[model samples]
Target: MTTKPAIIILSASALAMAARLATELDGEVHGLRKRIGDDAEVTFDDVAAHLVGLFREGRPIVALMAAGAVIRLLAPHLGDKTREPPVIAVAEDGSAVVPLLGGHHGANEMARRIAGLVDGFAAITTVGDIKFGVALDQPPEGWALANPETAKQVMADLVAGASARLEGDAPWLADSALPLSEDGGIALLASDENVNTPVSGLLYRPKRLVLGIGCERGCDPAEVLALAKESLSEAGLSAEAVGLVASIDVKADEAALHHVARHLGCPVRFFDAATLEAEAPRLINPSEIVFSEVGCHGVAEGAALAAVGASGELAAPKRKSRRATCAIGRAPHPFTESDLPGRGRGRLFVVGIGPGSDGWRSPEVSQMVAASTDLVGYSLYLDLLGPLAKGKVRHDFDLGKEEARVRHAMELAGEGRSVALVCSGDAGIYAMATLVFELLDKADGPEGLSDGARRIEIAVSPGISALQAAAARVGAPLGHDFCTISLSDLLTPWEDIKRRVRAAGEGDFVIAFYNPVSKKRRTQLAWARDQLLEHRPASSPVILATNLGREGETIRVVPLGDLNVDDVDMLTVVVVGSSNSSTVATGDGRTWVYTPRGYARKEGTAMTNSFSGDAA
Candidate 1:
C-alpha cells in the first residue's frame, strides 16, 4: 500500500460519494475546483491529465466515474499491463466496482475491498478470480509457491475436469475444491523434500523443519555441517525446509553453527536457556548436564520444539556427533514476513530532492538519505547534494539512463542493503518512483520472487514540485485553479499534449507549462501558445519563472500577446493566467500577478483616514 499512491477521482456531482470512498480506501479525491468538498485533495479542469498523472506515478486509482469515460481517457496512454498501476472504476451510484486495467496487479483485490464500502460486488474479469476465487499461481497468505510454472499447468488440468493428486500432510488441501485423486492426473505435492519435484508437480513447500544444534565452543565447522546434514538426511527432510536453527544465545556467534546455517542457507536463531528448559517435557531425550550448565534439560530437541511454537510436531529426534547434537520439528504453517529479517530482506527508499535546492527539501527525505547505505541517481543530481554523499557508496549514471539507474538501485536493495534512489522534484512526479514499481511488477513478487528479494520493502518520500516553486515565485498565479502540462513530448505523444492543453484552455484554467522549451524540442510551446490564444484573451498575464529555488533566479510577468518564446528554456516554467487573473503594480514599480479566489470584496469599503492623518 505504501508503494502505490491510492487515489479516488470523481466529478462535482459525486462529492458526497467521493467522501465515503476516500474514507474507506484512505485515498485522496480528485475533482474540479468548483467542488470544494472535504474529500478533495486536488482539483483541476483537465480530468484526463490528472488521471494520467496518477498513472504515470504508479498510483492505484479508484475513479468514481463512468467506465466509458475512464476508458477513453486511458486509451492512448496505456503501456505494459505488468507495469501499469491498478485502475478501478466505480459507478457514481456505487452500484458496482470494475477492475479496468491492472486486475492481476491488485485492481481486483482493491475493487473487492472498496466494494464493501458501498455494498457492491466486484466485477472481476479474470477466469481464475471469477471461478476459483483466488489466483492459482498466487499462493495464500504466508505460503510460498515453490513452482509457479507447475501451478499454472496443474490448474489448467483441473479446469479441464481432469483428476488431480493432492499429496503430503497439508490439512487445508482436504477442504480445498481441487479435483483430487490417488491415481493422479496432476500432482499438487506439499512436502518438505529438498530434492527437486517432477515437472508435473506443483510443490507447496511447507515450513516443516526446525533444525536444532548444540555445538562445542571450538567444534569443527565440518563436524557441525556433517551432523546437521546427516540428521536431515536420516529424517528424510529437505534442507530447504529448515526454516530455523534454535540454540542458546551464547551460541549465537558460534562459528560452527554459522557454518551449518550457511550450508543449509537459512538463519541461526537463539532462545534463552529458561525458555528452552520449559520445553524439556517435549524433548525426546533430556540431558542433566545441559540443564546444569545452560538451565535447560535439552539444548537440541527443546530449542527445536520451542522455535516451532505450540502447534509443532517432532519430526526428527536427537542425533549427535562427538561434540554437537541436532533435532528437527515441523511447524504447522510456512515461514512469513516476520521470519524474513534473518533471511536478508532489504529496504529501498526512493527520495526526491525538490528542484535542486536543500532548503525546500523535506525532513523525511533528508533523514532517509542520511540513513541510506547506497545512494543512486544521475551524477549531476548526486553532485547537488555533495555534503550528503560523503562516506556513502554512490552509483551515478548519465542522464537518459534512468531505467539503468533505478535497476541498479533495486539490485542493491534486493541484496539486503539500505539503498536510496535520489530523484529531483517529487519522487512520484516525473521521477524514479514509477519506474521502481514497474520493475517490481515485472518481477511479480507475489506470484514468484526469490525468498530474499521477495521481502524487500519499498517506500517513497516526496519533495516539492517545480510547478509549485514557480507558482510561489510569482504571487498567487495558482491561487484559484491551475493544471500542469508538460510541453516535452519525449514520452507523451504531441497530439495528447495538445489535447490536454486545449482542455485546460477551454475550461479557463491557470496553466503551468513544464519542460516548456528545450534545445532539441522547441515547437510544442509555440503550438500550445497558438491553441490557448484561440480561447483566452491576448492580454492574459503569463508568469515566466526561470532557475527558481536556485542561484540566479529570475521572475517576470508578460501578457499572453507578447510572451517572449526565445527567452524561455527547459529550466523555466510558464504560468499563463485564466480570464479572471489580473496584475497590480506595487510602490516599487514592480508588478505582481494574482488570481481571485472568488472571495466577495467589500462594496465601496476603504480606509477613511490612514495615509494623511497618521499621528492624530
Candidate 2:
C-alpha cells in the first residue's frame, strides 16, 4: 500500500475513537471547531464541505462517519474513478469500514488497513480484488496498462477461474497468484509493441522506455511533437511505455521541448552538460560540432542512457531532422516516476499559511504544505499549522532565527527532499521568501555543496494577507492605491521605513503598517501618525485589526487623532485611509471605513439610470 498521509474526518462524539486510528495511520484529524477536534491540530466549521475539499485534493480520507453521510457529501463532487481521491468511511463505533471511492487507486487497501485496526470487516466490493487478491489495472509501481478496457474483461475471467498464457517477457505476471490454465482463453500480454487486444486478452504496457530529444534553439513545437509520435509508431514502441523525455540541461527551459513532452503526455527530464558528456564514450555517433555547441557530443543518446541508468541500452540510434534529433533507450526494468530523476533539483515551497485560521488559508497553500516532506519555520508558525505538520519533519526555530530557519530549509531541499518554509500571511511580505533568494545570491552556486544545493527549486505560495483580511473586515479602505511598510527595524533601517511611509502620505495612498509596534518599540506608531498628520486630516479612518483570523480577533476603525499607539502590537495590521476615505454609519449603528476606488468626485454628479430613480 502507498503510505501517503491521510485526512481523518470524524464527528465530535467520535474524537476518542479517531485518536487511536489517527495515531496508527499517521492521519491528520479534522472535526467541528466548536464541538470536536480539540485534540486535532485543525478544526472545521462545516465537516462535509471540508471533507469534499480534502477528497478533491487527493488526500486519503478516513471518514469516521455514516456511509450515507459520506456519500451525500461527495455526491456533487464525484468525478471519474481515474481522478478521484481515495475515500474510506468507517463506522463511528469502528464496526464497519467501506471504501466509497478510488478502490483501484488504493481505497480498497486503505479500507482493509482501517478495518484491521478497528477489528471490523472491510466491505470490499471488487470480486477480482477478493478472488485473485489483485487489481490487474493497478500494475506494479513501475508498470502501466495501455488499454484498461480489455483489462476489465481479463479481470472478470480471472475472477471466474479462467487464465491463459502470460505473454511477453514479464516474469512477475507469469508468477502472479492468478489462477493459471495453460490453455485457457484469457491472456495478459506485457510488451512495448502496438498490440491489438483480442476478445479474451489485455495488453499491459511496461514503463521501460525513455525518449531523448535534441532540438534547435527555436524548434517548432508541432514538428517536434509530430517527430516524437511518428518515431514511436515507426519503432513499434507504445507511447505509454515511454516513461520520460530527457535532454541536456541547456534545453531545460526550452518551450518547444516542454510542449512536445506535454503533447506526448510524458514528464521532461534534463541532464547537466557534465553528466551528458560523461556518457560520451557510449554514444553511437559522437560529433565535434554538437560537442562545441552544447558541450556534449550526443544530447539524444547521452540523455537517454543517463535517464535509464547504466543497465539501459539504446533501442534506436539518433534519427536526425533539419531542426531536431531523437533517440530511444530501453530500461532493463520498468521505471516509476520515483525511479526517474527528472532533474536532480530539489523543491522548496515558501508558503504562507495565513493568520492561523483554516478558513482564511488558501487551497494552494494547503496543497503545497501537504506535498512537502519537511516543514521549516518559526516555532509559532509551525505550531499554527497544527495537524498539517503532522507527518512532516519540522525544523522549528525561535522568532528571530530566520537565517538559520531559511538556511536549514534550503539545505534540506538540496538533499532532494520537498521542503516547505512556512510563514504567516503572505510569505513575500516581510517573510522568508525574499531571504531565501538573498542567500542563493551569495552562494558559490550548486558546486558549494557536494550535493549541489544551489540548484534547489523555490516557489512562493501566497496566503490571504493580513492587510487583505483587515481591509475586508471593514469596507474597502484599500480600494485605491496603497503601500505597506514594516515598522520593525530589525533588518531594515528605521529611516528607510519612515521615508516609505512619508512617500505613501505624500501620494495620498492608503497605508497598511505591519509590525507596527512591540513592547520595546513604542514610539514608531506615534511618530508615523504625526508624520501622516502633516499631509492629511485628523479625522482620517484608522483601522486597528489585531490577531486577524485568530482567536481574540478584533477589528475596529477610529479617527486618526483618536488612534492609540499603545493599543497596537506586532500582531496588528493597521490600515490608515487616504484623504478621499470616509466613514458611514449603517442601520445597525456600526460605522464602516472606506476609501473610494475613484468615485468620490463622481458621486455628487449622479447618474440618469440611478437605482434610487432620481433622474432630474
* Best of the candidates, TM-score: 2
Report the alpha-carbon TM-score of model 2 versus the true structure.
Answer: 0.81
List the RMSD of every prediction in angstroms. Answer: 19.2, 5.8
**Best candidate per lDDT, number?**
2
Q: Give the RMSD in angstroms, all C-alphas superposed, for model 2.
A: 5.8
Counting only residues 3 or more apart in sequence or on different chains, how many pairs clash (N, Cα, C under 3 Å) in candidate 2?
Answer: 0
Q: Across residues 42-84, which tens digit of lDDT does each residue of candidate 2 receive?
A: 5778777788777777778888878888899899998777888
- The ten-residue window of minimal lDDT in model 1 covers 607-616
| Model 1: residue 521 alpha-carbon error in angstroms | 1.0
Write model 1 residue lDDT over 1-616, tens digit each, in one string.
Answer: 2332344555567777876776666555566654543235445556877688778767788888888898999899987766788899898888889999877667888888878888888898877666655665655444446777576676666677777687886665655666677997677777887656767777776755778889788899999889988998998887767766777766754678778777766666667788888888898999899888878899889878887888887789999999999998888777654553122335789998887765677757866876688999998778766555655799989988988888788878766777989998889988899988887777765543443344466889989888788777667778788898988788999889989999999999999898899888878888888888898887788888887777788887777877768979877888988877777667775666777776425566431111111100
lDDT of 1 at 232: 89
RMSD of 1: 19.2
